[model samples]
Target: MLTNGLEKRTLSDVDVRDAFFDELYRLAVEDRNVIFMTADMGAFSLERFKRDFPKQYFNVGVAEQNMVSVAAGLALAGKKVFIYSIVPFVTLRCLEQIKIDLCGMNLPVTVVGIGAGVMYGGDGPTHHALHDIAVMRALPGMTIYNPSDALLTQASVRLAYEQAGPVYIRLEKGCLPVLYEDAGGGFQQGFTQLRAGKDISIMATGLMVHHAVTAKDILSRVGLSVGIFDIYRLKPLNEQALLEVMIHSPRVVSLEENSRIGGLGTALSELCADAGCRVPLMRMAWPDGHCREACGREEIHRHYRMDARSVAERILDWVRNT
Candidate 1:
């Protein structure tokens, strides 16, 4: 999976924390002012960050609110701070602090939220981050990046480091199969067209991206042309590119691991409406409900009928009826 001579590309497992932490460690080594704060959620591979950069690393002992406040203070003092924690704790738990301390002041703080969507499926609704995208996108001056693989995760980390405003890095909890051999250098364009088709456009992010690709193949076998849009960046959407892609198909479907309310589906709908594109938009997301069943991510996806086979079947049915 090493594409473009990258040291590491594809991962066989579902854990992406190591890849992110490795990139953070590299940035911390080069920039002494790069500080890392966590709310006691880095159990997989945070020891290296603490051991190597003792002065720059801190554990806030599960206090997400205080962690954000402290990070804001550090950013004000001319320090580049990176906050890491579970999706809910960092985003929903400390929403107020993030709005005022980071977004209001336009500070250059990188908030990395692990366990995006239902990657923590068995952990129940409390660990699920279904509404993170909607909540974070509402904030002013916040850039969102939800990478599909380890390669994109590295690029997102670099972008977060270079940018001068609040940025949210939404990462899936488990190790995901490396989908793109290359991210075309980086996620500067906000989205990338993986496979082109004339029937419908499937826009997906994070873990759903791989499923979108699978759905494309499945639809292709039935003589249906399917196009895939890997939307890693949510907010500050690449409107121009999305419009161009929508031109390929009249029916566009937004697939995400988040809620149907304010996730990628909403963003694309708003973009299409603004551009006056007359394409029919459909969103396949978790409905308004909590995940009461404790199961794996794939099981949850199957239950919601968001799996590759289910998605392709639904599209086929819609095409036939319409």
Candidate 2:
């Protein structure tokens, strides 16, 4: 399939969604108290859980707001619950429920948002989850995990189970090349240094980490050594470590598919400001506008100059100009 002259990339051949649910399935098997609830989204991962543990599995039938409150109630009953739905609906539509029932009460419920950012391209702005991070992160006691690969995604399921308060997992639908051999080492720091460079550091979350990798390779050939920091944990990020790493580079760039208003860039900016550190920052994000593009994800990214070549050139321009 082609959209806007760019071949449509397969959304999730080796999907991280499966990895997340598979982990949940395993956990459910071991602990029947682990529950999986959804707002009518179906996947291969749901079959066994629904069949074997019917009581633990629920389909809320498109009622995302109700699902969140339901999840909170379940969590209050000493069950670790995960509420699933599309990125925007599960987060935006049920913002009140999540804010009050989950975060405000601080329950051990995982809000799994599928198709992070513009992955639901052609689904229109209504489906785009641009503000999930900003909104969820702002809520007190909300832990946000935006994993870039299947390994870390599975790890996030475990993290959600282990953590005490409300957790939000931002997931990408499509395939992300396996980046980590194992989910260990720097996993607890809430970020992973994918590659190290001195000239610039690209702080990216979710699948945008892959884009940062592409941009890193492009910049490498131009004699620019760029670091790629996969910031999986948006909230409760290891501030001292991230600040130290960001200062190592002359410039820091934040890349994400979400809206620029209060996403990754804003988080980094907050970190810098609170620390009284002064370093040039660039935010590569979806601009402030209603995105009406029906093109595929990559094509939409290309249109917004978020692809590798554009990001590389933009970085080079910034390096040259100031």
lDDT of candidate 2 at residue 191, scale 0 to 100 = 93
lDDT of 1 by residue, 106-172 (tens): 9999899988888888999999999999999999999999998877777788899999999999976
Q: Each candidate's lDDT (Cα)?
A: 0.86, 0.86
Models 1 onward score TM values of 0.95, 0.94
RMSD list, candidates in order: 1.9, 5.7
Residue pairs in clash, model 2: 11-174
The weakest ten consecutive residues by lDDT in model 1 span 1-10
Cα lDDT of model 2 by residue, 85-157, tens digit = 8988999899999999998898999999888888888998898888788888788898999999877887888
In candidate 1, stretches whose alpha carbon ends up further than 4 angstroms from where it belongs are 1-15
